[model samples]
Target chain A: MDAVLEADGLGKRYGNRWALRDCTFSLPEGQVAALVGPNGAGKSTLLHLAVGLLRPDDGSVRVLGQQPYDNVAVLPDLGFVAQDTPLYRDFTAAELVTMGGKLNRARWDASVARNRLAQLGIAPHQRVGTLSGGQRAQVALALALSKRPRLLLLDEPVASLDPLARHEFLQALMGSVAETGTTVLLSSHLLSDLERVCDHLVLLETAKVRLTGSVDDLLGTHRQLIGARHDGSAIPGVAAVIRESHTDRQSTLLVRVDGWVDETRWTSTEVGLEDLILGYLGDHRRQGSHAAWGVTA
Target chain B: MVIEFVLDGRSKVNTYMQLVQQVRQALRVGLLESGDQLPKVRDVAQALAINPNTVLKAYRQLEMEGLAEGRPGVGTFVTGTLAGASLMHQAELRADLVGWLRRAQTAGLTADDIVALVDTTIRATLADDVIVVTHT
Candidate 1:
């Protein structure tokens, strides 16, 4: 599959501090990818860079095979819902749809947006400011989908909603993707939600891309192993020891494997997507980036 | 089909496997008849808030198991049924299995040891007739 988005050593800094640096990954077309990380990990920065809202200070990013910074050709094919699903509080849902139609006139499908709002029982004339958080998010999502863009970028779209609302929002998002096959990059901290809707995974830590791949492949290749305590060195046949804890008598290690492990010496168990990420994130929380420790090399 | 799939978030089982198990269960209970059309991929994805690819993967697994078949441009349909008189003995068999498990536990076998023993015995006993799918 062709990559919808690609970055190479992408970096952006604010003043003396780097918000994102040495970032690199590619999102293939037709995959709903999850952009996840700890706070201040530059998720929003990456989204902004992708949508042309901000330019990278180092290296580059490509959306639909070209630089997106002020690139009008790629803008029409890209739809973005910034954090908080922001909209004009004064305008009603209908007016917002009208504005969206005018903004993307060539590709906008008004009726689809109208039908979606109607199905959700959101009145078209209802003011955006008065709508509930979930309703506003839905309206924003409807408008984004109405544009029928080839790629959709959502930044923490469900972070503010309650669990039920989050579920409904993901349902709607998946429903639209089912129909249109629109490639989506949704940044979120909810692992369970991502497990339901996303096929691809990207983990950014301390402003760098730590891991990126298909969710199934990632889950399949990673495992949790428990065994007698051993030296904190390389284990034969294991690709990388993602994290390891040791006591005087026992060791527990989360590792990436290539269909190879010393079964006789280790009791291995498969990890779910959530645990897999938590393992990596836990390691980061303890030792910062695994890169600095050379765990991945 | 008269069945709606539900997901258990904390089950530790693969999502697609949960879906497949649900289908098998519905078939075992006679809720999904041989001719019944499975839910559309889009419908399932929307209803369950899961990726369409996951739903497609589950349906493909069903097809592989000879329990269902998909028609181009249409949807998947059940083609096999596991419902039989054996289901009538489920209660009795379950009681005996529970008793055996309790006995094994009391006799100093850990859960994993009992599972391995039962699994191996089952394989040794039904080697030619069954394909064992051990769940953790």
Candidate 2:
């Protein structure tokens, strides 16, 4: 499998503060991956690095097996949708899409763009500024997709619209990916959404990856077990007991168990992605440790 | 293509779900067809101004339910043939409805009360059906 994105010992520093440090991960072509973290968790920094928007202080980054920054040949193969989603608000949707076609050296499929916009119910003749925020977003996205890039990088792509619009937008986006085979690296704060679209998840905190793997594998390894409350002191087979909720007769625990627990007494259930994330965040807070990263079993 | 998701205006359901439900309704109504390609996930995420991941989750669930499929190298697509999903989906929907009905029963609402509530709402909606007004 060819790697669509790769990084090694990646670090970014702002004066004395470290935004990201020793970050390492690679995503192959035909893979859809998500980067997840709390606000200011260096997710944007990582994305900037991957897309060649910003250079790293140390280490290297690549997109589609080539250096991403200012590399014209590689640039045409990639598409980027930023957080602010800048657009020429004065231009009409048709004018904006046409302008994108004129700017890109690669073939810009205008008909595809027009059809996609129409399917989304966005009027091509409407002025971008007069359009609603959601409609403006659609125009910008149409411009990006028109370019038909192989690798797409997006930062907080859907942080604005109302609920129904959000669903329509995502359905459209995923539908495109399924059709065009574009590999995407998306950064987001919504774990449930990530659980829905992403096969692989990269957990970032303090500028480094804490956990990275398939959702199924992560859930399989981490189990939440509920047992009789009185024997709650410590579980003999677990790796690390992080959180515990107890009652008079029964106790539920979030524990990192070593290997597998095939025991009948323990009612085991797979921990959700959100639960695992919250546990990671909570553990980070409790250790009183900053600038340190650890992957849970 | 008969996709349906819950949308509660004031309940604890998140906004992204409302988005999901509406899309499902569109599919159910034939507003979006089997061969129709959806907008890119990022594009939709950007338009709705919600988390891309939430939208992704909805798409993924739809895929798992066989209403959608994410073709490797291609984008996500609506299933051309929904015939394969009918039996499994029927069982799943039944189980889900049973769970909800059980909760309604526990809340002290009788079946008669529920039926009466539906009847009144339907009557109010149909009251203006015979009225005609001039067009501008």
Candidate 3:
């Protein structure tokens, strides 16, 4: 599979403090990948680096196998919607799309923008500033979709919207994905929302890549086990212990199983996507700097 | 397609499995018939706001089960009818089940409790080399 985005040893900082460090992940083309982490986990920083809004302070970042910074050649194929769905507040939807057409002349289709807004009941003449948050977000998404880009990077596009708005936004996004087979890497905190549209997962914690893989593969590899209290360090077939809790006579562990688990001795059950992610995040908090856990999905 | 799937986000069932089960249920109830087209993959994905691949996976599984067939350049169609002999007794069984559900509800079982009880009983009943007769 072709990599839509790639970063290696990526690092960034504000003044003396590093916002992101040692970050690395490759998102394959045509995969809707969920980029998740707590606030200040460098999700926005990583997205900026990929979208070429800012250059990395160290190492490298690539989009469509090319350095994205100042690369006009890649711009036509890449679409980005920054946080808060940024748009010129003064411009009407009509004028904004016309401007979008001029700026993205490579393959811009104005009808894609027009039709979407029309269906969404967002008037073309309505100034962006007067539109509700959801409407403005839709306009931004429509403009991005009109570019007909092969890749889209959305940074918390639906973070502020209500539930219905969020659903509508995702519906439009998924529709575009189905129609064009566009590769997307969107950052969001809504795991349930992500669970549906995202096939790939990239977890960032404390400025590092905690886990990233196809959701199906990750789910298959992780399990929750309960049994008599025992330190999880030497468990056979367990690739990594993500989280563990012990009582006087019992222990519960979430593990990444690389081989077969002895089902006869311990009760092993499947881990849902939410459980798998929370386990990793909790494990990271406890281990801090020197995480011995297997960091890959 | 006559049936439109509604997803329960909180359900423990996998999304694709839910889709497969919905289609099977539709078949058993005569909602979907032979030669009826399944909703297009893009339509279902867009409607449900889910990944297109998820819809494709469900369709693929349906095809694997001989319940559906895909035509190149055309849409998937219902190829197998699960309205078998057992389907004739479906109404009778449904009424009996409904009565039991009402009693269970009055007996103070919450939805989750009822689901757990039924699921455990099903597993215990279906244990060992029993026949797969409860196919619907």
Each candidate's lDDT (Cα)? 0.91, 0.72, 0.90
In candidate 2 the C-alpha lDDT for residue A292 amounts to: 55
**Top candidate (DockQ):** 3
Residue pairs with backbone overlap in model 1: none
DockQ for all models: 0.64, 0.05, 0.66
Q: Candidate 2, residues A127-199: lDDT per residue as tens digits?
A: 8888877766666667778888888888887777766655665666676675577788888776666655666
Q: For each candidate, give the interface RMSD after superposing the true interface residues on Cα.
A: 0.6, 7.4, 0.6
Chain A TM-score for each of the predictions: 0.94, 0.87, 0.94
Give per-residue CA lDDT, model 1, range A1-297, as digits (tens).
499999999999999899999999999999999999999999999999999999999989999888999789898889999999989999998999999988897789998899999999988889999999999999999999998999999999999999999999999999989899999999999987888899999899989988999999898899999999978777877988998889999999999997678899999999878888889988856644778777873
What's the CA RMSD for each of the models? 7.4, 12.5, 6.4
Q: Order the candidates by TM-score, highest first — what do you get? A: 3, 1, 2
**List of clashing residue pairs for candidate 3:** none
Please tell me which model should have the higher DockQ, number 1 or number 2. Answer: 1
Model 3 C-alpha lDDT per residue in residues A1-297, reported as the tens digit of each score: 489888899999999988889988888888999999989889999999888888889989988888888878889988999999989999999999999988988899999999999998888788999998988888999999999988899999899999998999999998889888999999999888998899999999888889999999999999999998986558889988888999999999999999998888789999888888888998746534444564643
Q: Which stretches of candidate 3 lie over 4 Å from their true place?
A: A286-297, B86-136
